[model samples]
Target: MGTLGRSGIVRKPNETMRMLVTTIIGVVFGFFIGVSFPTISLTKFNFPSNLIPSLNFTYMDNAWSSVTGHRQVNSLSGVPKMWVETNPRGAERLPPGIVTPDTDLYLRRLWGKPSEDLIIRPKYLVTFTVGLNQKTNIDSAVRKLSENFQVLLFHYDGRTSEWDEFEWSKRAIHVSVRKQTKWWYAKRFLHPDIVAPYDYIFIWDEDLGVDNFDAEEYIKLVRKHGLEISQPGLEPNSGLTWQMTKKRDDTEVHKETEERPGWCSDPHVPPCAAFVEIMAPVFSRDAWRCVWHMIQNDLVHGWGLDFALRKCVDPAHEKIGVVDAQSIVHQTVPSLGNQVSRGITLV
Candidate 1:
């Protein structure tokens, strides 16, 4: 509407509408500018998680990345990955595309996928150096282990076929190399990277009487006590070579035992503390890695390895111990000991 006045033509309502439109435009412009240019560095400061409403955290990450050219959280899935899960080889996965350093005893169908494991992966690995004579004892020992454990048997007497009589033998991995000592086989086959998938590794003798030992329960105790290197306590009367490995009737586990006087200079050292017999020792994945490297190629029988095991673990008294609740009979079979010819020229 226009009106004639001393000021010539006055646009009354039109001028009021113009003023209203300008006010609205100014408010909108200021709001967009404020959001676009934050006063603080978005990358340097961690904003309160709930500061923004109706926005996805990932979207916010992307928005911040787009604006500031820096993103603190790299994960595309919204939550930043605190650590990356990789193959044991890490970024150096090359050449062999089909297989990983980690292996399993799971059997696969010949016609289809080589990988039978998609859902279930065995969490632990239990290995035995066995002879046909100890089949019954080995059966009892394997039965003690749960389904979470994968069995691998090293046949020193070259009799893998006889093990098939047991139903579980079909699934058990057999590495038959006649007359080789367990340490020889371990050095070649159980490389740290090769067995990286297993949380714990049990390298045991076939003659162990495992009636009182439960592998799952033993693992629970090991974890509870933070034992990196351990063994089931030997029966008090069973070839009780070392006092540290002997079962104590009063304790669930024992780290130190009184040795014969004048034998040990330090009570906290091996054969008194931080000691486990090699016959039925169980090693954590990390401990085994260090022990495997310590194993010498020529020293096949693992002479003096019982004391050397203490070197693999620091504050050895704390990390190495015997679980008395799960105890085994040593049975001290002379299977490997009989190879006197090789033991003489052993390398």
Candidate 2:
């Protein structure tokens, strides 16, 4: 005799026994499978202690030319002699303090390497572009910088006659005023060495000075924050208060759209700040890509770089970082009356 329920099906004792076993088996099997397949980790990985000791930075074959208009090959080690001399300015031979890697300034620039075990100097491609119309401190700046960075100077003559000057010879490309087309002014031109890679590219104005600026520390923070575009706090030329736009506060942003109904609510956009100036903007490779693409070759005379950069840093795609620890001096020459009003869209 078998018990029948509303389903109108009666299970024999053997059938019932089989059903019970199968249910038990299914639960056990599922447990085993779950144990075998552990959950995946979503957290980003950082370099382990052991691995950090073994890593080294190098340039990919002939990578320098593409980034800074140098077409020829370049070696990465044995920094040029010009960089090691203490008296870069020759005003007076700086005490070994200026050139010594162990000095406080050097360590600060290198970001506090207590031992070689913690030091990781990522390779970089750096450049400076100066236009003829502006007055600049080219010689002193170059000599001072050659100590830590390899720089290629691009002069905007007309486009055809532009040449690149390196402290030492290498296969870097040069552009003249005529041939110095709009693309050269784009961020991509400053970082063409795609094969041998640098983590960051510093494209600065010639009027800017890098006093007390520590490159190594700057790089560490830039890498850690993973900012696409960033700047150090600026100091005004008059020695008055330096100005910078306040960062977008997440709370203030919410209030903004509530106050102004129908405000273009873009989850992807970051709030526009007070201003993005062009003094010494630091760019990660990611920032460079977006900036390079937005540059309009048609606007031949450099005008919209800052706006373009500002527009490119979307909250959904990139982060903006500012460093307050270090500052660069802007040699404020009075603006020669070319009141170029920057209408907003881009840097």
- The 0-to-1 C-alpha lDDT of every candidate, in the order given, reads 0.81, 0.48
Off by over 4 Å in 1: 1-105, 112-119, 337-347
Q: At residue 216, give the lDDT of candidate 2.
A: 69
- Give the per-residue lDDT of model 2 (tens digit) for 1-347: 89796899998988988999999999999999887533211112356758765543223322432353322222366332222233344423334455432111112234454566324333655555555544236545554543345455465544312223333323323443332433455443543334125556676666666674566676766666666677665545424322332222232111111112333245222233312455566677666666666766575445556545656666622466455555566665322222223542121
| Model 2: how far residue 300 lies from native, Å | 3.1
TM-score of each: 0.69, 0.44
Report the C-alpha lDDT of model 1 over 1-347, residue by residue, as the tens digit: 57666878676887868988999999999999888755333444456768854545555555655665333444566544322123234533233344456664565666756565344678999999888888998898888878899899998878888888999899888999978888888999999877888999999887788778888889999999999999998996586478888888898888998988988889888788988888888999999999999999987667689998998889899999999999999887765554446347332
Best by TM-score: 1
Q: What does the lDDT read for residue 89 in candidate 2?
A: 47
Per-residue lDDT for 233 in model 2? 54
